[model samples]
Structures are given as structure tokens and as C-alpha cells.
Target: MEQYKKDFIDFMVSSNALKFGSFTLKSGRQSPFFMNAGSYITGSQLEQLGIYYAHAIHDNFGDDYDVLFGPAYKGIPLSVATSIAYSKLFNKEIKYSADRKEEKDHGADKGSLLGYSIKDGDRVVIIEDVTTSGKSIEETYPKIKAQETTPGGIKIVGEIVSLNRMEKSADSDKSALDSITEKYGFPARAIVSMKDVIEYLYKPDGSGLITNDIKKQMDDYYAQWGAIM
Candidate 1:
């Protein structure tokens, strides 16, 4: 695994974003482990979270995008933090935009968007915490760009998430990222994946320690769902 990826795995464990055993996901699958981005609550954690995302996006998508569009709710902070980090890291202003789940009809800065508005001739990247299914994208992608009939016309350049579970989407045999890539030409990437998680943690816990049982559970779960990769 890349050193940044390894660091991300450790960060997950340290932040309690990643946990082991019997997680009943929203998809109703019995997952051996789970990730909850909400655990990154502290100022320092959020700061570091942005740093990780900024680096990952730079590595995967480069510094060319005009905007970072994070979806509503959880994505709001993600966009803000990453925009800050991107500006600092790459020495450029990367505008951030987000949708309102409940659009407010009033205000000078009204309508479904916040931060910079999506405009013509703009390139964008969607940022998110994780994608177990492509459901969120299904809901938000159209709102980002709709004037054109073809999805390729959307200015979205790529997507970056914290983790890729590497499991099938809720409805399909293909992984969510794979399906999204097929449906839309843009790339979907992660800072680390379940494979990286296993490789980093299988030998030892985040503290360079091991509890072999958890590793076995991880292995077994992947053995069943990991064949797609």
C-alpha cells in the first residue's frame, strides 16, 4: 500500500471511523467492518481529514478541476475542508459547491446551491466519504449538470472518497464505483480500499499490534465479496 493509504487506514482506526465486526449496513448486508465518517468530529481530525482527501484528489485527479462539488449534509464539511486544503496545498483557489436537501425559497443567495455556483466551462470533482451504492450519485449528479442530455456533457472530472468497500452495490453485481464509471465516464477513486485496509491491518492493529481474530473475519468477508476485484 502507498504510505498515504497506510496512513489513511491508521487514521480510520484512530478516529473510530472504521470498526470491526457484525455491522448491519444500510444495504442490510452483514458487514465484518464498517466506516462512519461522522466520527471525524474534532477540529484536528477534520483538518487532517481534509489533508488526506486533498492529497488523494491531487494524486488521482490532478489540480485542474474548477470546483469540488460535495453532496448535501455530510458532504458539506468535506467540500469546505478539502477546498481549504486544496488551496493551501496546490496554491490555487478551488471553489466548493453543495446542494441543499431542502432548498430554501428565500434569500439573496437562494436556490439549491451553496458556495460557488456550477457554471459553464467549469470542471468539477465530487467528494464524498464512502459509496456503498451509487444511490447518492443517482440523486445528485443530475442536479450538478442538466442542460445537456448526455452525462459526458457534465463537467464532473472525477470523484474521490475516503474508502472503497469494494463490495457490490446494493442492487448490482458490479461494485458501485465500477457501475458509476460504466454509466458515466468520470473516474471514482478512494484514498484506500478494503484491500488496502486488510493489507495494512492484517499483520497488526493501528498501533503495530495484532488481534488475529478480526483479521480473519476481514479475510473471510472479503473472500466472499472480494472476487469482483
Candidate 2:
């Protein structure tokens, strides 16, 4: 595994963003582990989180893209943070854009989008905390596609998420990220995967964040809900 992947795992553990135990996911699956990006509340934590995301984005999608389109709510911060980090770390000025749950009725910027105005010929990369069943992308993808005035449309270069749970979707045997790539015709990637997390944290001597029992539970959970990948 790469150094950033290991450090990100440690960051997640230290920040309590990634937790092990019984938890019910939005996809209605009983998961042994869960990750909540919202746990990074402090300025320093958010800054570090942005650096990690910026690194992942640069590695996976490169800095050639124009816009970072984050979904409403949680993703709004992610987009802004990563855009700032991208500028600082890579010296690239990437625009940040996010959707609104409700459109503004009266304003100069009276539309569903916030931040950068997505226009024709812009290339967008969607950022998110995690993808479970891919319901969020389903809701936001159409809104993004509608922004294009020309026939070719604005290009969605790719998607970046903090973690890949490596679980199957509600209706498909493929993982949520994989489903998104197939559906949207663009690649979807994560900073680190569950496999990397297990490899780094699971110790047979029972001296790791993931103990023997917890590893067993994870194995069982994967057997039932793991993606075909």
C-alpha cells in the first residue's frame, strides 16, 4: 500500500470517522464497519482531509479538469475543501460547484448550482465522502447533465470518493463505484479500499485496531454483501 493510504487509514481511525462495530447503513445492510466523513469538524482536520482528497484526485483524475462538482449538503464542504487544497498543493485553481436541495427563487445566481457556474466545455469531477448504494449520484447526475447548453454537453471526467466500501449495490452484484463508472461512462475511484484497511489494521496477535473477532465479522459481512470485484 502507498504511504498516503496508510496515513489516511490512521487519520480516519484517529478522527473517529471510521468505526468498527454494529451499524446499519443507509442501504439497509448491517455493516461491521462504517465511515463518516462528517467527523472531521475541526479546521486542522478538515485541512488535512482536503490534502488527502487533493492528492487522491490528482493521482486518479489529474489536475486537468475544470470544476469539482460536489453534491448538496456534505459534499458542498468536500468540494470547497478539495478545491482549496488543489490550489495550494498543486498550484492549480480548480473551481468548486455544488447543488442546492431547493433552488433560490430570487437572486442573481438563482439556480440549483452554487459556487462556480458550470458552463459549456467545462470538465467536471464529482467528489463525495463515500458511495454505498449510489443513490446520491443518481439524484445529482441528471442535474449536472442538464447544465450543458450544447449537444456535446459538459464533460464529467470522473468521480472521487474518500473510501470504497467494496460492497454490492442494492440491485446489482457490482460495487457502487463500479456501477457508477458503467452507468456514466467515466471512472470512479476511492482514496483507499476496505481491503487496504483490513490489510493495514488486522493483526493476528490481537494488537491492531481490527481484532480477530472483528476481522471475522468483516469477513462474514463481505461474504454476504461484498461486490463481485
Candidate 3:
């Protein structure tokens, strides 16, 4: 695993955002862990989070994407901080845009709020903390496609990039990204897998935060809920 990813995981653990315990997810599955990006509230914490996200983007997606699209709420800061980091580190100066739940009808532009206006056919990379069933990303997809500012001949494209990808759903037809890429031929990537975190925590150099009992519990949880991908 990359040191940056390990550090980001450690940051999540330290912030109490990433917890190892009995928890139920949005998909109604019992999980051994959870990650709450909302716990990062302070400016400094958010700045650090952005740095890690920038690193993850740089490491995984590199210059492949023209713009970063963050969904509403949690994605707002993620988009801002990440763009800042990308500008400072890679000198790429990436553009970012996010959505408002409701369209603002009376602005000077009277449309979506984009940090950088998304042009039609622009290749955009979507960022998020995690994925359960991918409903949120799917919901945001059409809105971007609907942007009036996008030129008629130009196409609006979206790809997903995230901190983690949950295990493939046992009852589902495809993994979250697979469903998108299968349809649109866009790509998806992640910084690290939950299995990587678990393995990291078990090593001698581990923070000793995850005990043998916790590992057993996690394995058992996976047996029922499926292993972390």
C-alpha cells in the first residue's frame, strides 16, 4: 500500500471517522467498519484530507481527468480541497464543480453552480468517500448530462474515483462502477481496499488498534456480509 493511503487511513481512524465495530450500512448490511467523512469539520482537518485526496487522485487517476465532479454536501469541500492540492502539487490546476440540491433559477447564470463550468463532452472524474450501492453517483449522472451550458454536439462524460469500493454485491448484477463503465465505458478507481487496511492493521508495524479479536470479528462479518474489496 502507498504510505499516503496508510496515512489517510490512520487519519480517518484517529479522527473517529473510520470505526471498527458492529455497524449497519445504508445497504442494510452489517459491517465491521464505517467511514464518515463528515467528521472532518475543521479547516486544518479538511486541508489534510484534501492533501490525501490530491495524492490519491494523482496516484490513481493522474492527468486522465479534465475536471473533478463532487456530488452535493460532502463532495463540496472534497472538490475544493482536492483541486487546491492538485494545483499546488502537480501544477495541474484541475477544475472542480458540484451541484445544488435544487437548481438556482435566478442567478446571473440561472443554472447549476459549477466551480468551473462543465462543457459538454468534458471528461469528468467524480469523487466520493465510499460506495455502497452507487445510487448517489447514479443520481448525479443525469443532472450533469442535463446542463444547458454544455454544447449540443459535445458529450458530457463521468467517471468515478473514490477512497474505497465495497465488496461486489452478491445479489447485484454488477459492481457499482461496472454498471457505469459497462454502459458508458468510463472508468473507476480507488486509493485502497478495506482488505488492505485490515491486512495493514494485522502486521507488526500496525498501530495495534485492530486486535486479533477484531480481525476475527471482521472475518466473521465478511463471512456473512462478504469481504471488503
Candidate 4:
């Protein structure tokens, strides 16, 4: 793994965003662990989170993307923070755009989009926390593509999430990220994987250590719900 990715795993644990325990997912499967990006609410945590995202974005998607599009709610802050980091890290300008649950009828920028306008020919990359079932993309992509400012429409170059659970979606055999890429014609990348999480916690390192029992639990969980891709 890259240094930033390793550091991000530690950051997730320290922020309590990634937890190892029995949990039930919205898909109705029992998960051995869960990652909630909402735990990163502090100043330093968000700063580091943005840095990790920026690095991963640069690595996977390069610096050519014109905008960062985050979904509503959690993705709003993620888009803003990563855009700031991208500007600072690469010294290149990047716009941040996010979706709104409903169009604002009384606001100045009264549209479904909350930030930078999606102009035609704009290349966008999505920043998300985690993608297990790809529900967000299914809900938001059409709305985003429909609002393109030009005839050619905006192009979504790729998407990056904090973690790839490496589990199949509810309706597919491939992993959620893979399914999204296959269906949408763009690549999906993550800062780390559940495999990385398990390896980091199982072995000795500076972040933290996991017990042997927990290691087994993680393995067992993967056996039940994991996807190879």
C-alpha cells in the first residue's frame, strides 16, 4: 500500500470512523466491521482526511479532472475538503460540486447542484466515503448528467471512496465499485480495502493492533460476504 493509504487506515481507526464489531448493514447482511465517515468531524481529522483523499485522487485519476462532485449530505463536505486539498497539494485549481435532495426554489443558485456549475466538457471525479452497494450513484448520476451546462454534457471521469469493502452488491456478483465501473464506464478507486484494513490491524504497526480472535472474525466475514474483485 502507499504511505498515504496506510496513514489513512490509521486515521480511520483513530477517528472511530472504522470500527470492528458485529453490525447489521442496510443490505440486511451481518457485517463484521463498519466504516462511517461521519466520525470525522474535528478540524485535524478533516484536514487529514482531505489530504488522503487528494493523494488517492491524484494517484488514481491524475490531475486532469476539472471538478470534484460529491453526493448530498456526507459527500458535500468531502467534496469541499478534497477540493481544497487538491488545490494545495497539486497547486491546481479544482471546483467542488454536490447534489441537493430537492431543488432550491428560493435560493440564489436555485438548482439541484450546490456548488460549481457543471459546464459542458467539464471532467468530474466523485469523492465518496464508502461504496458497498452503489446506491448513491444510482440515485444521483442521472440527475447530475441531466444538468450539464452544454450540449455535450459533463463527463464523469472517475470516483474515489475512502474504503472498498470488497463485497458484492445486493444485486450483483461483482464488488460494488466494480459494478459501478462496469455499468458507468468509469473506474472506481479507494484509498484502502477491507483487506488492507485487516492486514494493518492484524500485523504489528504504529496504528493499532487487532486480536487473533478479531482476525479470524474478519476472515470469516469475508468468507460469507466478500467479493474477489
| Best lDDT among the predictions, by candidate number | 2
Which residue segments of model 4 deviate by more than 4 Å?
149-152, 204-208
Which candidate leads in TM-score?
2
RMSD of each: 2.3, 0.9, 2.9, 2.0
Q: Where does model 2 exceed 4 Å of error?
A: none
Arranged by lDDT with the best first, the candidates are 2, 4, 1, 3
lDDT of each: 0.84, 0.93, 0.72, 0.87
lDDT of 4 at 18: 90
Each candidate's TM vs. the true structure?
0.92, 0.98, 0.86, 0.95
Clashing pairs in 2: none
Q: Write the per-residue lDDT of candidate 4 for residues 10-96, one digit (tens) a residue.
A: 889889999988999888888878899999998888888998999999999898799999998999999998988989999999999
Tally clashing residue pairs in candidate 2.
0
Q: Is candidate 1 or candidate 2 better by TM-score?
A: 2
Write the candidate numbers in order of decreasing TM-score. 2, 4, 1, 3
TM-score of candidate 4 relative to the true fold: 0.95
Model 1, residue pairs in steric clash: 205-209
Candidate 2 lDDT over 1-229, as tens digits, reads 8898899999999999999999988767889999999899998998999999999999998877999999988899999999999999999999999999998888898888999889889999999999999888889888898898986579999999999999998779999999999888999999999999999999999999999999999999999999999
Give the range of the ten consecutive residues with the poorest summed lDDT in model 4. Answer: 203-212
Residue-level lDDT for 23 in candidate 1:
90
Better of 1 and 4 by TM-score: 4
Candidate 2: C-alpha lDDT:
0.93
Instruction: State in Å the error of residue 84, model 1.
Output: 0.3
